[model samples]
Target: MTRKPSGQRGPVDHERRDQIIAAAHEHFRLYGYKKTTVADLAKAIGLSTAYLYKFFESKKAIGEAICSLCHDTLLSDIQAIVKDNITPSEKLRKIFQSLAHNGAELFLHDRKMHDIVASAIEEKWHAAIAFDQELSSIIRNLLLEGRERGEFERKTPIDETCRAIVLSLQPIRHPALLEYNLETLDNDATMIANLVLRSLAP
Candidate 1:
């Protein structure tokens, strides 16, 4: 039997890398980042730890990849909501609520995974920064649309107003703020959104 050339391993290598990432994601979600070691991930995929290292240099590397995937999924959701055929005001409200809801679910469903996110943010990970920038951009675009539609009045520059909006809702969107009870978090989000809307009213 003829063996495949080394250059022909691209597709197979990509597939294996993805498999390793998926396995690591599940392990981290279930067992927390600190508890889920490279050995565990390799065992899950029926590979040796040395082989896993060929795909990801370290466990932190795998964790970063997983965080990137999650952030991409979130950005896609926000992008879709922004482009939906809804009033700018309604879209803004939904975007705020969706972000709060997603953060809360992540905190409550898997504290381990949430901890990974917290560390990523604290470490200033590239994926975390990109995620934050994308979210800000979405909000800024929505505010611009609102201004064009005369649904909102901007007392300050659009960029400043966008920053204010994000800061005002940080309690709901920030992982550190997820320590509050669910009811309190929900109420705070509602009140904050209302205040932002009122501030932006024409």
Candidate 2:
């Protein structure tokens, strides 16, 4: 029987890689990134540490994969909101609310997970930066739509306006800020939406 070439992964290898990532997520959630080790993750998935390393380079890599999964899920949710058939103003409001609501639920619910997220941001992980850029682009697209639909009067360049909108709503959109005062996200979202809308009025 012929064996697969070295470094070539088959279907089973992919499945095992996914299983390791899933198990690592749970371990990170329960034990936090700093405390979780490759051995713990490998044992949870019924694999030896050396075998797990064939899938992930290190425990940090596993943590990064978990973080990427979360960011991808968030981007999907925001993309859905952006695609909905609704007025730009309403979409903006919903987007603000969703950012705060979902971020708080994901990070604030578990202190260990929150710490992991904080560290990711501090380290400027590639996934985290990509997530932020995508979100900013979504906001930019919404602003352009508002301008095209005659819902907003231009006071500045569209790009600048979009940046301002994102910066202005940072308290409700930034995970760290949201974590600091989650209880007021709902009220703050409403107020910020109204203020932004009024500023954009013709």
Candidate 3:
């Protein structure tokens, strides 16, 4: 939640923060990180840079906010897919569907998202890898669990399987792969997710 320095607003500060994030998401999706500037974002959000400053110190902060939102959404979707006490195969199928259903919109709308994230790799590598690592850990642990549960093939190393899932996700970084393989980015998401899930399933 963000508080007005003047203490003038009498509402939940979280709402105001969400509004800022909405604006950031729109602007960044359109102009991307390198092309986006503080002044433009401030103007679009109908606030002065000084006021915006009170909430976000820099463009990178906005990028971080965007990344955080995407990461949370991805995790939530994955969690929902696995929330029920279903079989491993069903969990894998749902994971693919969830990622495919919503993930394509993310890449199509903001093609520059990966670049913005990649640029931050050197400085914020840990933060940048947090989502993938967490998801990979989940995959690895699940595979181990699945093996013990007699629900999966007992062949490849768990780490290797997890790495494959994460690497399949990396195809989004390729412009041609994103554009050509499927009719649209959204279509691509489902196709890729399906393939990944199959690779892990028996």
Candidate 4:
């Protein structure tokens, strides 16, 4: 996650930064990310463009913040899934399904916000990287639990297995790649999760 900017205006004031993000989110949602400008955002919120820079370095930075917020919320939901009273196998299935559905919702319904995420993925922004890392960690823990419970094989190293599972889900997980598999993402997510579970069989 990018550090929330702080300047000579005393301690960090997230109220202003959050205000900027709230406005940007609405603006981006309305006008799309690429077509919107920082100055336009400043105008929308009644702040000067220079003052807007105090919280975010550039337009991309603001985009990153918005993108990160989305990722964080999704991650929290997924984390709750992990904590649910479900088997590791079932958790894995749910995780993949949720990811596929979320991607489809973004691309098919929220095109404007999807544009921000697409750019974040294309540019390998911090938000995307951080989301992937944290997700991989969650998957790793799930795999370890499965192995300990004899629900999954332990022959393969967890890291390699985790990477393979992540890669297998990437077609649906990635924004840029979502369109190609849009028609079959729901079925594909379940099928892929099942396939991974089979491979992990003890």
What TM-score would you give candidate 3 relative to the actual structure?
A: 0.68
How many pairs of residues collide in each model?
0, 0, 0, 0
Query: Which stretches of candidate 4 lie above 4 Å from their native place?
Result: 1-13
- RMSD (Cα, Å) of model 4: 2.5
Estimate every model's Cα lDDT from 0 to 1: 0.78, 0.76, 0.65, 0.87
lDDT of 4 by residue, 1-202 (tens): 4354212232355688787889999999999999989899999989999998777778988898889888987898799899999999999999999999998998888888888999988988888888888999999999999999999999898899999999998888888887888999999999999999999999
Q: Against the correct fold, how does model 1 do in TM-score?
A: 0.85
Backbone clash pairs in model 3 (N, Cα, C under 3 Å; residues 3+ apart or in different chains), count? 0
The candidate 4 region of ten consecutive residues with least summed lDDT is 2-11
lDDT of 1 by residue, 1-202 (tens): 5322121223334778778778788778777887878888889879999888776667777777777777777777778888899998888887777877878888888777778878778888766777888888888989998999889996679989999988887788778876675667777777788888989999
Best by TM-score: 4
Question: What would the TM-scores of all predictions be?
Answer: 0.85, 0.84, 0.68, 0.93
Best by lDDT: 4
Q: After superposition, how far is residue 26 of candidate 2 from its true place, in Å?
A: 0.8
Tell me each candidate's RMSD, in Å, in order: 5.9, 5.3, 5.8, 2.5
- Which lDDT value does model 1 have at 18? 78
lDDT of 4 at 76: 82
